[model samples]
Target: MAEENKQIAEQLIEAVGGLENIESVAHCATRLRIMVTDKEKIDQGKVEELDKVKGAFYNAGQFQVIFGTGTVNKIHTEIIGLGAPESSSSEQKKDAAQKGNKIQRLLRTFGDIFVPIIPVLVATGLFMGLRGLLTQEEILAIFGMTPADISENFLLYTQVLTDTAFAFLPALIAWSAFRVFGGSPVIGIVLGLMLVNPALPNAYAVGSGDADPLYILGFIPVIGYQGSVLPAFIAGFLGAKLEKWLRERIPEALDLILTPFLTLLIMITAALFVLGPIFSIVETGIMAAMNVVLELPFGLSGLIIGGLHQVIVITGVHHIFNLFEIQLLADDGFNPFNALITAGIAAQGGAALAVAVKTKSKKLKALAFPSSISAFLGITEPAIFGVNLRYIKPFVMGLAGGAAGGFFAALFNLQGNGMAVTVIPGMLLYIYDFLPFVLYILTNVIALSVAFVLTWMFGFNDKMLDEVNQ
Candidate 1:
């Protein structure tokens, strides 16, 4: 079976231009993405003939040969060994056109790593940030909770679910990483968990008010990447490699035993001592960069991330930031993720709103209006994929409007610290001293309304209305 599979893999590689014609290879749930220099060079017919290639596709301006779940990476290696080509500008343009896949692949990557256990992350972060706004004394006044309210069983239950995510964020990342990369992320995660766990010995008892402990070389020290990105990513990378090697080489007879044994030994030592801490530092540096971006002139950050937000979502990399946002809520009170997402939804909704007004096709109009409303409520997938993505002018208009909304919203310091929904009004949460909360709210409202109006006025207008009146 292995020999036959290898031969088929080799045949598949040869059909796709001996691998040299290929560029980079990536995969999501259902597809294998291969970037090729000359699309003409690939023998699509021969590739289709391969038993391993369930189906074939060409997308994102890239030549893609689809493969089922675990098969992608194996074939990818065989293809790379056969020789993939280097990328060029024209190739880059083609990949750009395949924007949707790029987004999907990105999200699948991060989501694959994180989605299994995101509810805790989201609910916890939301509670903590919002709770800050409703402190002990404030909670007592607003909700009429006595001092006992702080220790109430209900509150404790809520804290357990939410704080669990925060306290062992890196461990969760490690677990997600394990799913993605297949090493002992469990070890990395546990190491991280121990660091933040109040029950653990000393566990940063040395620190005062967020001075966070940092103990090296003890019980496999791992820099907590809880609510972090880079550290889990790095550990997962190593773990996956180790896991893959173990999966392929370890005997099936002792598979369960040896696989984890080897995986844990290699992954634990590497992650705890190396990847865990190293990537934590890297994560911090990236956060610093994000802070710099956030601190930039209000409209610019909005314009950039807002305009790019939907685009990023399409490529699936947006979840990387979704994870990043969780990290943001964990370490800081305010987060740009929700605010930026609000812009994306509004921008997309504006485009769909135009289509609903302008398209002659009943089908298009039917899809557009409802979809637009959904995006307004913070659900952008349907509008983006079913409407705006299908139409060029509307999408561009939406993007422009989004950029404008983001720019001004950021300018006005409009933010939603908790449970930020997609609707324009969600920005109401950021109102505070030194923040132009009211101004942001008004300007953003104007920007989206104007975008919808302009889209209809210029190209999306009802020509039939005039003819019928005449």
Candidate 2:
């Protein structure tokens, strides 16, 4: 197996125009992310056809070859062993900035800032779902206890599990943004904490009219930035930039003390008095616009977003949705977008499964089956690029399936207790409510069935496979 992996690694290096052409290489979850000096020299078709390679695509100025999860780690190790330059984070970011267009780079930055924070949110979401399920009136009735019978301490414990992340979400975002933008993370955390300081009016309370905003200069309104994304992100960016600039100018002896002191003083004043109020309004407007779309008559919103979701994924800019979804969860405490997108994800898996079942070639079947499973498990790139997009029609069928399921999702007013997980594993999010859980399952079934049936009937055949193989 080691020798075979080494051979595949050698082939990959050669396929990408030899080791000299590779500027740096890295892997993330499922793909071998390579930065090459010359795109024209690399043979994309050969890269996709290499052993254990599911598919390959160029996005954000990187040639990413999907090898699935465990397989990718092995292949990456083999590549590095063969003397390809392993990318440092700084080198990768530099390459991304130089290679990608403005929109791609912006989206990548958002991804970098949010990806590390997702696991915390996912765990909190699961905690929320579990707590919701356990505390339902029906569940309580089974135990011959009412809501009043439950211990207040236990409920408080559940709240700790579910609410802490969101309550201090600004801190997490700022910390992540600081790291991404090259600032002292500890300083970022301090600055973020100042935004949500107990001294200020709570943001949610101020919005709900339960608490009035404190007046700065008797004109400007100020409030804590709990559960906020944009303001925190912007503040983190500005703070990081300011910190870097100050570090360059400040004397080495005073750098540690003076830089942070000046940064916090200037940024906190700017954040509370200027950036906070301005961006908070902007963020609210964006949230309101999203709500309007989600509330569109007859599930049209779902149909549009669901159908186009996977197409967006193909561009590698789908990370942009992280902001929208996170905002939905923070502002509304429920995420309808999660329900809408799951249908799109499920359809990809279904379409891939159809191709796997129908393909005659052993090689194609081998790629399609695991790719389908990977999609069902909440990652879709393998199924998408490896099988569905390669066929063209399967991808379209999947889109149709997504539209159908999304229609049902919106029509039924389906909402998830959290975000992040999707498809089969996403079942955890719906378990909080029995009816919603059933409807969520039904939505996925409709999506999977529509894509599978459509692909089986018209999207694929052995003839097309034979032609491609030839």
Q: Which one is best on lDDT? A: 2
As for candidate 2, its clashing pairs are none
lDDT of each: 0.61, 0.91
Which candidate has the highest TM-score of all?
2
lDDT of 1 by residue, 53-143 (tens): 5446465556656554466667655555545543433344346455546555565567566666656654554565455444446456788
Q: What's the distance in Å from true for residue 58, model 2? A: 1.7
Cα deviation of 77 in candidate 1 (Å)?
34
Write down the TM-score for model 2.
Answer: 0.98
Per-residue alpha-carbon lDDT of model 2 for 1-470, expressed as tens digits? 99999999999999999999998999889988899888899899888888788889887668889999999899999999999999865568678788778877888899899988999988888998899899999999998988788899999999999988889989999999899899999999999999999899998998899999989899999999989999999999999999999999999999989999999999999999999999999998988898898999899988987788999999887888898888888876788999999999999999999999998888889999999999889899999999999989999999999999999999998999788899888999988889989999999999999999999999999888756666
